[model samples]
Each structure stands twice: as structure tokens, then as C-alpha cells.
Target: MTSEPITVVLGSASPARLRVLRDAGLDPLVLVSDVDEEAIVDRLADAAPEHVVTALAQAKADAVVETIRGGDDPLFDAARTDGVVLTCDSMLLLDGRLSGKPHSPEVAIEQWHRMRGSTGHLITGHCVTRLHRGEADAATGHQSTSVRFSDVSDTLIERYVATGEPLKVAGAFTLDGLGGWLLDGIDGDPSSVIGISLPLTRRLLTDLDVDIADLWRA
Candidate 1:
């Protein structure tokens, strides 16, 4: 590891992912990628949820990496020297169907109706692009968590949907937000369910020969 700390370039606009990293002691520079998620998902219509999420995450990372390589933005100068671009995409797989952000109140309500009292697999793909010593390398992986929803009533679902939280998040629920009240339990990493998997991220950083500790805030 370099004596200098590695900067974290978060290639996502998700507040949840940024919070996850910040709470874990790493301060990340947020860079939102303009990748068309719906287009990518449509292109991989028949692929497994794991593969789809991974492809989406890689696409986002690649987009941001291109911007960093352009060298036009002084914001990325530190990142170009010794930084890791981390991107993630998450979806909920239920009954062989994949669902990303509902993006609509009606869709959120429908998703909750189908998910209430049922279990869904929350899969989050992670991609890490390391820019160190003028060379860039990447590693990708995913984490899957089984989340069980409570037998919430329609009235409650309607109330939750009114809050508009479900419309902006995958699975129409969250373990660390207002939706937490509607979830019974989770069988995997809770951090992944929130947005990013700390353990999986650590392993990916290891693959790129960067220690997670080296990326921690001073």
C-alpha cells in the first residue's frame, strides 16, 4: 500500500451508499454517473439478476472512470493519482422477476402488495476501479441478501407509499429508513440491503491490492 491514503471516488448519486461509507470512517468524493440503467437492464433482459446488476455497476464505474481519465476536471486530480472509483447497483428479485427503483407511487404500491409477507432476494453488484501509480485496474462482485417483509396491511402500505420513500429505492423498502418498520428480517449483510456491502467492498479493494484501512479518513 502507498504511504498516502487512497481517495474514494463514489461513482453513485445514492445518499445511502455515501452514508454507508461515511459511517464506516471513509469520506468519499461523490460523482454521479449518467449511465442509462433502464437501457442496460433491457439489454440484459434474459440474464440472471446477479449478472444484470454487475453489468450495471460496471457501466456506471466505466462512465465515471472515463471522466476521470479526461483530466479536464480538477476535481479528479487526486483520484487520478491514488483513488478507487466505487460503483454499485441494487435490485430486488422476487418470483423470478427483477425490480429496481419503482419510480412511481402506483408501481411502489403494487410492489409492496406483492412483497408483503414474502421474501425477496436483494442483490447489489459492486465495482471498484483502482487508479494507483498511473495504472488503473478493476474488480467486480456482488452480494445477495434475503429480506422478508412483514404482513403489513394495505392501509399501512398506502401510508408508507405516501411518504414517497419506496418510490426512490429498490425493493420498495429499506432496513435503515422509514420502510424498516415493514420488514420482518434479513438473512444477509444489512449494509448491502441499505445500498453497499462493506464486507464485499473490502474484499474487492483487496483484489485491487488496496487495503480498506488505507482508504479510511484521517
Candidate 2:
């Protein structure tokens, strides 16, 4: 573990990502990047699911970096110097189409119907940035996991949608919540399904010269 404490900034407002970092014993500052995620995704409409998620993650991190740089707050400046920024985006790939967060309960129901009794790929893209010797050292990567869902009934889908958990999550389901009941199994990192992949995040941080052991020490 390093003697110096590193300020880890999470460039997202996701509670799940925040919890992941906290569980890993790192105190991360949350900064929600105000990027037009849907617009960015639209621009890459022809891209693969993995590429789309990766691009969105990078866009989010870049937006946060720019936002911080444009501000004159001394605290923000200090944070930029002493902290690492982490950003991530997730998407679901079913067949050849990308499934995103549902815009409404109706959409959630439809997506759930499509996902019923099917297996899909959950892809999460992560970006980590830190200031090093007058330049920013940024690294971007992604993790893909296969998830199989049990057969779901319309009654269950409607009930889940009414709970409002599906509206804000990619693929219209939360792997750690009531939605887990719909999943049969996962072939990769379960944390990725929740929103962020901790193992992948750790690797990116390590590549950026942040010590994972130090960050994980309670």
C-alpha cells in the first residue's frame, strides 16, 4: 500500500459504481458528466455494442475532464492533480442489436419481453485518467459478460417495471436487485452486470499507476 492517499473521482452518478469503489476501500468523489449519451450512441449507431459502450465511456470521461478544467474552483484544481477520474458505460447486446435503458415503462416491458428466455452479452466500458508529469495519462478498456435469463412472464415483467428499477438500468434489468430472479446464470463478472466491472476497473487503475492494494486497504 502506498503511504500517500489518492483521491479517486468517479465520473458518473451511478450509485452502483460508487458502492463498488467504496467496497474496494477507495474514497471516490462523484462527478456526473453532463454528456448527451443518447446522441453519442446515435452517432455510432452502426457500431458494435462493445464499441458503442467504449466510445460512450471515453466521451463521458472527456466531458468530465473538460468540465473540471473549465472551472476555477481551487478544490477542483487540487482534485485534478491528486485524483484519478473513473468513468464507465454499459450496454446489452441481444442477437445483433444493442439494448439501452428504457425510456418508459412501456418500453421496459417490451424490452423485457424481448429478453425473456434469451441469453445476451453485457458489455461495460471503463476509462481512467490521472495527471502525470504535466500530461494526463488516460486509459480505456472494456469487459464483456454473457448472461442467460430464465423465461419471464408478462405479469413478472409488468411488476418489475412498476417497481421502477428497470427504467434506469441498461437492458431494463438490475442484476443485483429483483431483476436477478430473471437471470439463469452469468458467464463473466457479475459486478459488470450491476454497472461497473471491479476487476476491469482495478486493471485500468493499475495501468494508470494507481496502486490497487493501497486503494483496497481498509
Could you give candidate 1's per-residue lDDT for residues 1-218 as a string of tens digits?
Answer: 56887778999888999999999999999899999899999999999889999999999999999888875788788998889999999999999999999999999999999999899999999999998778889999999999999999999999999998998898888899999999999999999999999999999999988888888888
Point out where model 1 deviates above 4 Å: none
Q: What lDDT score goes with residue 144 in model 1? A: 100
User: Model 2, clash count?
Assistant: 0
- Candidate 2 lDDT over residue span 79-176, tens digit each: 65666788999999998989888979999998888889999999998888885434677888999999998898889889989999889988888788
**TM-score between candidate 1 and the true structure:** 0.98
True lDDT of residue 116, candidate 2 = 90
Ten-residue region with minimum lDDT total, candidate 2: 73-82
What residue runs in model 2 are displaced by over 4 Å at the alpha carbon? 1-3, 74-77
